[model samples]
Target: MAARVPGPRPDEERSPLAVVLDVLGADEQRRTRIAWLYYVEGLTQAEIAELLGISRVKVVRDLQICRQTGLVQIQINGRLAPCVALERVLVQRYGLTQAVVVPSPHDPAHLPATLGVAVGAWLSEKIGPGQTLGIGWGRTLHWSVRALRRREIPDLTVVSLLGGIGRGSEINMYETASRVAETLGAQCYYLAAPAYASSASLRDMLLEQAGLREVLERARRADIAVVSVGSLGPESTNRRIGLLDEEELPGLEAAGAVGDLLCTFLDAAGHPVDHPLNRRAVGLPVEDLRRVPTSVLASGGPEKVPIVKAALIGGYVNTLITDERTAEALAAG
Candidate 1:
C-alpha cells in the first residue's frame, strides 16, 4: 500500500514519518543532510554549506526545515555543571542567594589573602553605585578589604557596623574599616567609642554620644551588611583581638552561644544566642544583621565548620564565601 502523505501542519493522527515527509517549506533531503551535518556533526553553518556547495543562508533554512520536519534533536550535556550545581544546592538548602567556595589555602596564613581577593572580586560585582555597605571589623574582613580594588562610587556610603578598637592583637578594627572606606572611595562613619565598655551602664551612656549613635543608626539603615563569623574557641580572633572578653564568655555560653557576629552570638541552630553583648556591644543586633540582606565570609578549615554552620542556620548570612574544604564540610552537613 502507498504510504499516506501528510499535511504541512500535522494533526493528531499523523505518523512521525508522514510528518517528516511533509514538505514544510524547503528541500527535505538536502535540508535533512544539512541539519545532520551542521547540528549532529557539530559543523558550522558556513562549513556545512561550503561542503555541500550551498549558501550559508540555504544551510540555515535547511536546518530550520529539518527541525520543522522533526529530523533535528539537540540536548544539553549537563545543567549547571558540577561546580554550579554545588553552588545551587548550597543556596537552596541554606536559603541563600549566592555562595562562593574558594580552594583551601595552601598555608593557613595565605588563606585569608587568597579568599579575600576572590571575595573582593565578588563584591566588585555585588555592589553598585548608590548603595550603603556596612562592614564589621576583624582580620578576615581586613583581608577581604585588602583584596578589593579601589573603585569610587560617589553615591556609595560605607560605615562601620560596630564600635572601634578595644585592646587586641588579631587585626586592627580601626585600620580595617578605614581601608575599606578608602578602597571604595565612600564616606566612613566610624563608631566613635570602644566596642565594649567597663559596664552596661557605661556602655549605655557611651551609646548616647552623638557620633556613636549616628553610626549605629546608619548601620541599621545599611542596605547590605558584611561580617565575619566568630567561633567560641579560646584562641578565637574575637577573643584574642579583644572583640570579646573573658568575662563575656560565660554569659555567651549560658546563652547557648557557639559563635558570634559583631559580638552577637548564635547557637548551634544558628539562632541568636543573646547575652551581655546585647547590653555592652554596640552595633546592629545579630537578628538585625539577619533581617538585612547580608553576606558572611569566614575562612578557617574544619575547626570553624560548626560555627559556620550555626551562622548559616541562624540567618546571619544569605551569602557565604568559604574555602573549598569548608564548603565540602558544609555539604557534608
Candidate 2:
C-alpha cells in the first residue's frame, strides 16, 4: 500500500502576494505587493509594512516604484472629455458661437453642480457693462448661480424671461436672477408674474403691463441668453415649477413635443411643437433666441439628451455645456 499522503504545509498555501511575487519576481515584487496591499486592501502604508514585515520606508519606496512602473494606472470614466470633443463636433455641425462640456460625476445628477461651475466661469468672463442678458431658469441654472465667481463689472442688466414666484425652494428664478445680478455687479429686472398664465390672452395681457413688457422687450434685445434645455417627465422643470399641468402635457405631446427650450417644446428634429402652449409662452421665441449672440449652457445626464439635442438642432443655442455621457450621445447621434 502507498504511504499515507500528507496535506500540504501552511506555507505551501498560495497567497495573492506570493502569486504576484512569482509573476513579477524579487526586484519588482516588493513594490508591486505594497501597492496592491495598500490600494486594493485599503491598508495604510504603516499597516502594510507591519503586515509584510518590512520597514515603513521600504513600503513607501515600493509604492513609488509601483507608480513609476505604471502599476498605478488611473482612467477617468465620464463625459467631460467627450463633451469637449462634442463641442468641436457641434461647432462644425451647427456653426455654434461657443460650446462648453462639463464632466458628469459618476452619478448623472451630480452633473448639474459641476456644470454650474463651468457656466459660471464662462459667464463671469463674458458678462459686463451695457450688455442686456436674458436668463431662463431651471435646476442647472440655479447651480450655475451658486458656482459663479463674483466680478466687479458694472452696468450689467439681468432680465428674466420667465416669472418664478411660487412656494418652491428659495433657489428659484428670482433668487438665481438676484444672485447673478449681484455677482456680476449688474441690475436685476424681475418679471413679477406666473411662469405660465391660464391662457394666451392672459399672458398677452400680463406682458402689456409696463414693468413686465419692459423686461420682456429687453430680453428680446439681449446679447446673451443663458438657457437650459428641459426634458419631459414629471420631475421636469416645467412640470415641477407648475408651468405645465398634467392636463396640458398630453396636448404638448400630441403637438410632437420631446422637450423644451425657454417654454417652447420641440420634436426630435428640433422643430417647435407648435401647440397652444407655444402661443402662450412669454419667453424669447426660438427665432429670436437663435438670432441673438447668446451663450447657451446645458448640462445634466442622459435624460437631458433629447432636449439638448433638439436645442442644438433648432439653432436656439450657439454654445452647449454638457457632460461625458451626453457628449457621447451627441457624437453617437
Candidate 3:
C-alpha cells in the first residue's frame, strides 16, 4: 500500500513553497528509485548520482521529493521491523483507532519518561482551539507535562478527571491538570476533593456539590481524554504515594484486581473489581470514558500489560501509546 502523506487539502490555501514542493514530488517512479538507493542501500547523493547516471543536484532534489511525497518514511524501529508490524496487529486486534509503539528504554526506570515524551508530542498535535481535554494523573503523565510544547489555543479547556491527592507530587491529579492548562494557556477545572473519600457516602456527597459536579460533567463531555493505567502491585504509584493502604493490597488481589484507571481497580476482564475502594473512588467511571470522542491510554512495563489489555477489552480507550516491550507482550497474549 502507498503511504498516505498528510498535509493541507488540495482545495485549501497553499504557500508558493508548498506548490513548488508538490510539483517536485510528482515523479513517483524516479523518487522511489532515489529513495531506495539513499535509504535502503545507504548510498550518498554523489554515489547515487554516479550509479544512476544523474547529476548530484538531481539526486539531492529527488531525495527531497521522496520525503515530501512520503516515498521514504522515518521511524524508530526497536527490533528493526517488529514495532511497525506489532502496531498494526494491536490496532486490528483491539479495535483501536491508533496505536503508537516506541522503542523501549535501556533502563526499566526510564520507561515512564520515554512514553511521556511520545504522549506529550501527541497531545501537542491532537489538541486544538476550543477543545476540552480530560486528563488522568500518574508518573508517566507527570513526565508528560515536562515535554508538552506550549500552544496558544483559543478557548481550550482542561478538566481533571480525578480528585487530587493530599500528598504533593508531580503526578498529583490537580498538579497535572493545572500544569497542562498552563502550558496550553487554557481554562482549567478540578475535582475539589480527595481521590478517595473516607467512605462511599462522602464520595457521593462530594460529587453532589455544585462546583465538583460541574467539573465531572465537563470531564465526561470532553473531546479528548488521556489516562495512564496503574498496576495493583506494591510498586504501583498508588501504593508508593500512600493512596492505597498496604493491608488493602491482599484483599484487592483476592478480589481478582489487576490494575486501575483513575484509581478504580479493574479485573483482567476490564470490569470494575468488586471491592470497597471502587465505591469510594472519586473520578470519571471507566465506562464513561468510552463516551469521550477520543480516549488515549498511555502506559508500559511488564506489570501493566494485563491491565492495558483489560482497558482495551472494556472499551475504555480508543488510542494506546506504549513501549516496544509492552507491545510485544500484549501481542503475544
lDDT of 2 by residue, 9-74 (tens): 978878798787688778676676777888888999899989989899988887876643445543
Per-residue lDDT of model 1, residues 1-333, tens digit only: 999997566555778876776755447678777877876689999898789898999888777665433355333344334446667777888889888766666787666666666666677777778888888766567767755657797788888877767554446656777777888888788877777766789998988888888887788777878777678887687777656668868878888887776766678897765576767776767777766766555555665778888888877778887777777778877
In model 2, what lDDT does residue 198 have?
69
Q: Highest lDDT, which number?
A: 3
User: Ranking by TM-score, best first?
Assistant: 3, 2, 1
Against the unseen true structure, what C-alpha lDDT does each candidate score? 0.73, 0.76, 0.88
lDDT of 3 at 251: 89
Error of 2 at 295 (Å): 3.1
* Whole-model alpha-carbon lDDT for candidate 3: 0.88
Residue pairs clashing, model 1: 270-314
Better of 1 and 2 by lDDT: 2
Per residue, candidate 3 scores C-alpha lDDT tens digits across 1-333 of 999999878899888987777776646656788898888999999998898888999989888765534355454435547777889989998999999888899999999978888888788878999899999999898878766777688999999999988877867899999999998999999998999999999999999999998999999899999999899776789889898999998989999999998889999899999999999999998889999999999999998998999999889999999999999998887
State the displacement of the C-alpha of residue 309, model 3, in Å, after optimal TM-score superposition.
1.1
TM-score of each: 0.70, 0.72, 0.76
The candidate with the higher lDDT, 1 or 3, is: 3
- Where's the lowest-lDDT run of ten residues in candidate 3? 68-77
